[model samples]
Target chain A: MERLGSGGREGARRIGEVLTWDPLVRLTHWSVALLVLLNGAVLEDEGQPHVWVGYAVLGLVAARFLWGLVGPARARFTSFPPSLSAARLHVDEVMHGRERRHESHNPLGALMAYNLWATLLAICATGLMMESVAFFGVEWVEEAHEALFAWLMISVGLHVSGVILESFLSGRNLVRAMVGSFHKRSGGGA
Target chain B: MKLAPFALALAFAASPVIAQEVAQGDKIGTEIGAIASALSERGYEVRKTEREDGKVEVYAVREGRRFEIYVDPETGAVTRVKEKH
Candidate 1:
């Protein structure tokens, strides 16, 4: 967001690269992204690979949640507490062209991130249950797994769109920030 | 992104076809209860019996070992037994 002044984009006040997401954050983010895609679309659901991928996803998510509790200042859950009121205020601020800086995830992003994690965990739980003798070929268990997966797919679409929209509004490549240690030094909220 | 839902729909649509295809031996129907009893006689505690891919799959446990016992729907003959991990 540091480039907002030089870029001459009105209401875009942030500029230059600043350290945002930590290495673990970026690693888990992308890894989960790939694994979700593989398990959701690429791999055969009945195949062993899909089950393994689900386990990997659950482990990564658990690690990420732990990091949120005991990680760096910016990566902690306190930095981006999920709150509906704050998210609503953020929307109002955006609509009024009043850009604000957030040290971590913006309120809306925080809520979505939490949603993604919770939904992912539920998906894994259902998947694991299906492998047991009790739930094997159980109608409701299978139905729940598929339904949760569909919800995950929808959440992923919203996530990508939100990233693009936030990047455009802030005049910074959020993608670049998540990809590496540095982000453009600018006044923008992820 | 779009393909996920499409694929999911396709999966749901394809399952009923498998349910319709279980016609083994002489096309004489072997009821679910009959299959369960047949498997129970083999010391298998039957949990579920479902028609899949032209066979009646009986999910059972024998001596605490989980198994999938595939039976010919017509003759109720044990065709395959797979131990699940």
Candidate 2:
């Protein structure tokens, strides 16, 4: 997974020198972000555009699920399996000031990633239910969709905060890494 | 500095800015049962009635199609009927 970024020292270096997010990962990430923002803030909630955007988000998530299985080593779910113990250990290490820098996603980040994906799936499901004739005007389903959307927003805020915190701790520009092709190298263990 | 016209245009274009103010007087027929009965008279099986703004939104079904009827609570008049697809 560590080698998944650069391949070798002599590969492409468009923006910087490291590649943390692959094309599929970056595409899905930004697409989901834009679609969610459009649906939540810009478009009318019950409008056709909002429904289409929701479907697009669901499609992006579905594609990401497949990519997690057959994509690069860094993008795979196995690379950062959700583990409560691992997340606790990461938090403990952070508290003790002995946290090791992970080249891929850290434990807490992995959990957040899984949380966002699952929450998005739930939101999409509820949204679809609301569209169906059987579930039309179903108050609980609409409420569940609204609740999941709130959770997604909260997860996004936490994810960005964690990224900034990790960047400071590990001396890596994660935002830049996501934008371009390279993450600044920092000496730490996974 | 000189982009006031463009900015105003953009603001209106991006306006999520429709505001409707409903008068909240003593409603004559605002009860859920009353709304359900009113909808039942229209050949609808009333499932739920929710008070939204100054209107009662009745979710009802007739045959197979679902309908959302917005009714004036004071007048008991159906303001709008939206078929839920």
In candidate 1, what are the lDDT values of residues A18-86, reduced to their tens digit?
Answer: 334666888899999999989878999877899999999999999999999988767788888889999
For every candidate, the chain B TM-score is 0.58, 0.59
A117, model 2: CA deviation in Å? 0.6
- lDDT string for model 2 (A87-190, tens) is 99999999998998665679999999999999999999999988777777778888899999999999999999999998788766788766653344443322
- Residue A120 Cα positional deviation in candidate 1, in Å, after optimal superposition: 1.0
Model 1, stretches more than 4 Å misplaced? A1-15, A18-20, A181-190, B1-29, B41-47
B81 Cα displacement, candidate 1 (Å): 1.8
Model 2 DockQ (Cα-based): 0.29
> Where does model 2 exceed 4 Å of error?
A1-18, A181-190, B1-31, B41-43
Best-fitting candidate, scored by TM-score: 2
